[model samples]
Target: MDELDLKYALEAILFASGESVALQALARAIEKTPSETRELLRELMEDYDRGMRGLRIMQMENRYQMLTRNEYFPYIRNIVKATPASSLSQAALETLSIVAYRQPVTRADIEYIRGVQSSSSLDLLVDRGFVRIAGKLDAPGRPVTYETTPEFLKLMDITSISEMPKFEEFSGGIQLRLEEQPEENGQQ
Candidate 1:
């Protein structure tokens, strides 16, 4: 097909899927090389941006998705009557952070890092589709391992976990203080 036809084909595929399409899959669909297809996709993205269209194409790693621009969320929400998703609690957010950085981690590891049980927080993250069971570790009891999902990446507005800020960048500013407790025996 010609250039315009190829662009339309890519656009249609992205719109119909309503999800991220892999670069290889898109290339196969358009019968073009991966590099050529990537170039075409970039041009289409630019066209949308230049036209000030309500829709935008986002590239997440090797995949591409067509989505309504964030600026138009109010209008889309009004038409869809969508309810606002509940925000994650501090505990859940902490659990999610652990899973994101040390993925394929187990509940035991998460609890150890947080210094508390993380069952509820982990469950909440699983329910929200931000985290998933990757598999089980081959240790003694074969504990289940957890990993962050693509939905988590989308929520974070990041294409890859590598984009996350380095731990050292923020760790330097945080300080932890523990209070001493009185002994129950009352033996001065």
Candidate 2:
């Protein structure tokens, strides 16, 4: 297709996709080689900039998503139906991180790391899309286990759970120290 046709095609795909679309996926959908698709996308992005449009194509991780310029968010928020404000608390985030990195884990296991009862926090994470019930463990009670969802990967901008950073990568923080604080003080 010609340049204008290619621009329209790219814009349609980007706007239609609610989630970030990988370049490979975009190329396949448009029947173009990856290099050709990349060139077309770059041109389209430049056109948006040159025209001073409020929307832009953004690369996050290995995929692309269309986003309105930050300066325009206030105006857009006024006109559009607002998405519900959803956020995980610090406690919920910690529980999510543990389950995300150590998938197919049990509640008791999560409580061990957190050093506190985590049933409520786990319920909250499950209520959100971040965590999911994986299966029953093979041990005694056959308790249910949990794992991170693709939604979790999308939120974290990661392609896979394996890409999550190792716990040692986070070991030096005050947060990490706090995990073992009760243990060090001879408390359960």
Candidate 3:
């Protein structure tokens, strides 16, 4: 299909689907190679961003979805059909932060660092779509490992995890003893 045709097809599919559309599915629908489809979709996404639209496309892993721009979230929330979501608890936020930084980590690993039973907090993060099971570790338990999703990056207002503030800098204040924390907590 031509570029304009492909763009319209994508727009129609995304808006009508009301969900993330897989890259492979989009490629098949457009009768294009996956790479070409990706490029076109990326261009489309950029166009939406640059066009001053109230909506934009978000790529999550290998799928894309149409999403309202962050600037419109408050207004959207004001008109939503359900009760507003409660804010994340401190423990949930802590667990999410740990997973975002020490990604592919296990519940055991998180509990070890946090010194608490983090099952509920971890579950809350996963249920909220901020965290997901990445893979199993090559350890004794072969534990299910966890990682932050693209949604997490989007909510954090960063394109990549590298843009997040150093985890050590944020947590070192508590990680170290008073004497060590003052001089050598996160300087490195």
Candidate 4:
């Protein structure tokens, strides 16, 4: 391979190695044959050793990982900024549950089910990356539809929505009809 081609291949491998670099993904990214990429990587690893760089390429569990030479982690962490994480409220949790169960539902539908306006709660869900606007529904008037994101699955620790708790069987106390209340015709 030429110098430019090899440089691009090396850069792609390094960037992908930040996470695990699978051979197929690296091949697709580099648009080259997997065998050639593997050879290039071996050469790069050898060059890295001969240059005395503080980084190394490693193969583990059928994936490649590019990491600092272990002696440099403390220096790296000290230079990075740290921020405190925030917690979600009970209201947000309930709203999230409703969205998770009834998506791709609209914001109005969520409000109707919760018996309250949910603009703020919808904003919170979107901000936290759990819910996303799937697209507008194709009904009489188009209303934005929302669905739980893959991030939601990750946060909830589930591989799929089928694993969610069954809410269909829970009957009654949830549906309080307005008309069922006793008539208040000036009765004490």
lDDT of each: 0.85, 0.76, 0.80, 0.68
Summarize candidate 2's per-residue lDDT along 100-178 as a digit string, tens digits.
6677789999999899899999998888777899999999989999987666766765555556665555654546444
Error of 2 at 152 (Å): 1.9
* Alpha-carbon runs more than 4 Å astray in model 2: 1-11, 17-75, 78-84, 173-188
- What C-alpha RMSD separates each model from the true structure? 9.0, 7.0, 4.8, 13.3
lDDT per residue for candidate 1 within 1-188, as digits (tens), equals 79999998999999999988999999999999999999999999999989679999888768889988888889889889877788999999999988887788899999998999999999999999999999999999999999887788788777776777765455556552434321122110
Residue 96 lDDT (model 2): 88
List the candidates ranked by lDDT, beginning with the highest.
Answer: 1, 3, 2, 4
lDDT of 4 by residue, 27-118 (tens): 67777787877777777767666866787666532345565665566666688763334777777787887777777788888888789888
Task: State every prediction's TM-score relative to the real structure.
Answer: 0.81, 0.58, 0.77, 0.50
Q: How many residue pairs clash in each candidate?
A: 0, 0, 0, 0
3 versus 4: better TM-score goes to: 3
Q: Who wins the TM-score comparison?
A: 1
Give me the displacement of residue 67 in model 3, in angstroms. 1.0
What are the clashing pairs of model 2? Answer: none
